[model samples]
Target: MTPSDASPWNSPGTVRQLGKMLFDHNPTLKINPSVIPSIVGWGLRFLANSTYERHKANMISNIRIARLSLEALRSIRQTAHLNYDQTTRGTMRVFPRGGRMTEFVQMCREMKQWGVQFEVLDQNQILEKEPCLGAVIDRYVGAVFFPDDESGDAHKFTNEIARLATELGVQLLLNTNILKIVNGSSSRISHLSTSRGDVSADVYVLSLGSYSPILARPLGISLPIIPVKGYSVTVALNGWKGGPTRPVMDDGYHAMMVPMGDRLRMGGRAEFAGYDTRVDEEEGWRVLDDIMKILPVLRSHIDANAVLNWSGLRAMTPGGPPLVGPTSYANLLLNTGHGPLGWTMACGSAKLISDLITHRQV
Candidate 1:
């Protein structure tokens, strides 16, 4: 995990971008009419809670948490011996504009103080590291390489972990839709009304990503989380020798491209639309177009029509840090609102929650 926040929702340029997204007809960031009221309410609360001092404190805490997450994932990878198409080739953050490179240099100095390891690379060094980017080298001013950062398949990791958990006596319930959380006479959650049946638990942990707020609202728990939609397009590399060997984050377009086995997955854009999970083909094309600009060589090797488009909602909090640990209900705990860093922070978040539940040192 990187020490700096690169999310479009929480970056330094968020305020200016938010203004455009709210007012202008920005293609990348859309605000549906129905979500405006909710957005306004959340915006007011966000402003009230997000003071400069508070944000600084949260950033420091989150940096520590992110470090721990990276360590935890490494430990799991080594100890479990589970292969999820993991790679340690690191990630490169390329800056197209000189101004963005300056901002990143400032961030690098700040992160260095926190013990985050990174190397600043010039155009020559960046091209040397990944020669596939040579075609678009002129488009970049500079780059930052986080050698400790990693890339992997989240779906593979989850399946492997689930299999291991089942061997450890944890029951698996598939295709069970949680209708609602039902509470008994006491203050805690009694059982969950589900598609299969009502299931009771001694302690309940809410980890339903973007949909957590929807379920928590019935319990008077106003989680300050909004579902921010994002898109991804995966294209088969077709044995393309010019494809990037590692992950690359394009600072200019707020997009990222990662090599996943035989496929190259690129994701970007943040939409403020409410709960709509529909995959827009136009949006997919736009994301593909943006990523192609960063790696123009992909045009000849891969067929544009063979790409897979996906869309998902990320649970974002007003403040960057996720809502973890206990809630008002003693038996209920929260482990959501991770935004774009959900996969990066998942193992550490799970560890923290487990320690909390076990009453161990966290």
Candidate 2:
């Protein structure tokens, strides 16, 4: 069934309905709902600790803020296929999930207009309150933490939209690598040289994934985007012991595990290996070590010999946020440099870019 038929994700109410359906039925989407809190906690705690001695309190408070925002969302607002754990991250607790494959982003202006808080629930509290999770009262659950949000299938989402782009008479070439760009005296991009023959469009979008820099240099602009390599090991789980009921992550080790349909996807690490897709089983093992930390009871279930390792280069910009505005070029627009959050912000970024170029609104 089509996405619209599957769920009316456009509205917040439908998001809850869709999420509940997925969380209950689609095991793939029912993953790592607990990371937002952990990442929010540690990231802020660092800032809080350095700025003052009470950063820990500030971090927790910030999580509470995120919690309020998350709580505002009806249960099942969005489902994820990812999660994070901080068992190896010292006393810090904010853990986030799956690729956080954000199903979509509702703009802050829209949220305000809709009378919804711009912020979601506290990230930490998300972990303690996950429907898929359980913990003793007053005893914090060390689970994936984050504001209640959702993620979708990125490959399908990208391919589907890219197909729509093609339907609208937009020419897209896959497996054709872009090599260099021709710029003019004004430093505007005149043409793009690729493995395929050259034909120019009135405007160009640099949604080139990790290869964003290959386009930015021609315009005399330097995007601080870098290729941060992350690896994934997809493995089938036999039962609760071999499989995880909830998503988990260990931010300290930069590793995370996701419970996908029939497979348990484990990944996390920024090995800047420049255009390499090689999967290191040893590195995967290192990541797995962090998983064992949180669920030590499942150590017996560790099939050290079983893993389907794969890698993807995430385009990371210097600033944690992405680059999604027009460039110095008169017509060229940018929608890349998203890094891991690409899935989180894909639709929002696309709509934003489309508005700017298609309608001249930022």
Q: Pick the candidate with the highest lDDT.
A: 1
lDDT of 1 by residue, 114-209 (tens): 766788999999998889888889988899998878887777889999988898899988899999988664467889999999998888899999
Stretch of 10 with least lDDT, candidate 2: 1-10
Per-residue lDDT of model 2, residues 1-362, tens digit only: 00001111123333334344344421112222343342344334323333322422332332332233234222222432222211111112223443222332222223333332323334454443332222221232233232224322345545655665676797767788778766654635677788986757767778887777766775687776656677676655556444433444443334455655455666665554566667767766665665555445445654657767677887755333467888877777888876665554555566667678878732
**Residue 76 lDDT (model 1):** 76
Residue 19: error of model 1 in Å?
3.1
Worst 10 residues of 1 by lDDT: 3-12
Cα error of candidate 1 at position 82, Å: 2.1
